[model samples]
Target: MTSNDLGDFLRAHRARLRPGDVGLASYGRRRVAGLRREEVAVLAGMNTDYYARLEQGREHSPSPQILDAISGALRMDREARDHLYRLAETLPDGHRTQPRETVSPMLSQLLDGYTNTPAFVLNPALDLLAANGLADALFSPFGKAENLARMTFLDPAGRSFYAQWHRAAEAVVSSLRQATGCEPHYPRLHQLVSVLTESSEEFAMLWSSHTVYGKTHAAKELIHPEVGTLSLTYQSFDVRGAPGQQVVIYHAEPGSPSSQALSLLGSLNATRRRESTPER
Candidate 1:
């Protein structure tokens, strides 16, 4: 999160593509790996010097049209394109502020209403802000389920819990990258990224890829300690009044084995809660 972050972002993404990847013809063996600056300039319909200036942090402001051209040239996805716009400070006003991390009482109550589903609220940094009973039971194997990124990379159980561990890791890292693009100056997010990058080699590798993504819905397979594997789909909703808070709810197909397993898990959680409560 420096003055040259835009330049760094451009460089990292530019290094990921080859001349053939973008339909550009190759003549001789190139010294560098990915597409050169001149190729990107040609693709984006801009001067090579202007593109180089943008990559060197010499150009501060870039128009939306120019960002779009660059995005198309880089073959960026929707999230990456938005990230590029954000990096260049081309977004409209009022979008640069830090997202609120606190979960509201109404949101917590909504989470509680999903009695049989695994539901939780997460902040911009992927911190677990609030969770319902089933969610608690779902993530009980982690022991420390405070942050999704931390649990996925730092905890040994994560690899076992997530059936597709690498996919999960990539998703987590890309989502964090999207958050970073939104709030580059957030100290807590920076701290979390630093900790994960230092602790986990996979995290560091993915972080350097400069991928950006915002999770809306996805299918996941989780292996529970007590219930075995559960194939579920989760939907993420942004909190109305809160900028960065999101509610994630997981559910399985009706009458499926995974659904039955989730029901059994819910029953087990309820029984455990009752057993722990004292007679009043």
Candidate 2:
């Protein structure tokens, strides 16, 4: 990592906010976007030169209290605050370990038990490690359902499969940014980012934004070739034993048309599986 990575991250996030965002009064027309360096320093309760040196990469180490102050001054969310701490190398003790990517057999079994719900497990880099039958059926349109990032950006069916493709793209990119901060030394994460940046212009633009977000729960709309459009809400849970692995389960409102479509898709998927099996 470059010495200026922390500075660059701070600059990017600072440019994303305005004085009014943090309840600070705006003066005359500002020359630069977002909060000025002095404004941030005042808000963070630090000297202007100190904050400038930190942003200019001259300051190597910042205390936890200082980092927390900067985080609050910038109005960063939990994920973004964590990223800021990681960038400054001031992460709390026991928080710097690498995430274990392995999905346990029990977790795989839990995914299978979802039955009607579409559930899958993903690593920090968005690799789809394991998925239930419904998830497989839901993502069948993709040529490869192995990685959510790849499926959303590189796959032929990606644009059409997602009802809100742009939103999906933004979410994935921000999520990747969060992951990169959490695991800066992970080789696979770097590779994935490099590939996506080279392969997709949209991905490149979003990646450049330096937004950090981790998916917890969200509503999504997907179009299935066999079942048409389905509106679903997905919840992402961190696997207890597996650090980096997250189990995402998608469900539709009970008695809704989307729910009926999901049930139909599950039935069709089961029948297809049965038909493919040999009668021995």
Error of 2 at 129 (Å): 0.8
The true-versus-predicted C-alpha distance at residue 216 of model 1, in Å, is 4.7
lDDT of each: 0.90, 0.90
Among residues 3 or more apart in sequence or in different chains, the pairs in candidate 1 whose N, CA or C atoms overlap within 3 Å are none
lDDT of 2: 0.90
**Candidate 1 lDDT tens digits, 63-118:** 87788888889988867876887788797333344678777888889899999899
Q: Please, what's the RMSD in Å of model 2?
A: 14.7
What is candidate 1's TM-score against the reference?
0.67
Q: Among all windows of ten consecutive residues in candidate 2, which has the lowest summed lDDT?
A: 92-101
Tens digits of lDDT, candidate 2, 120-168: 9998999999999999999999898899999999997999999999999
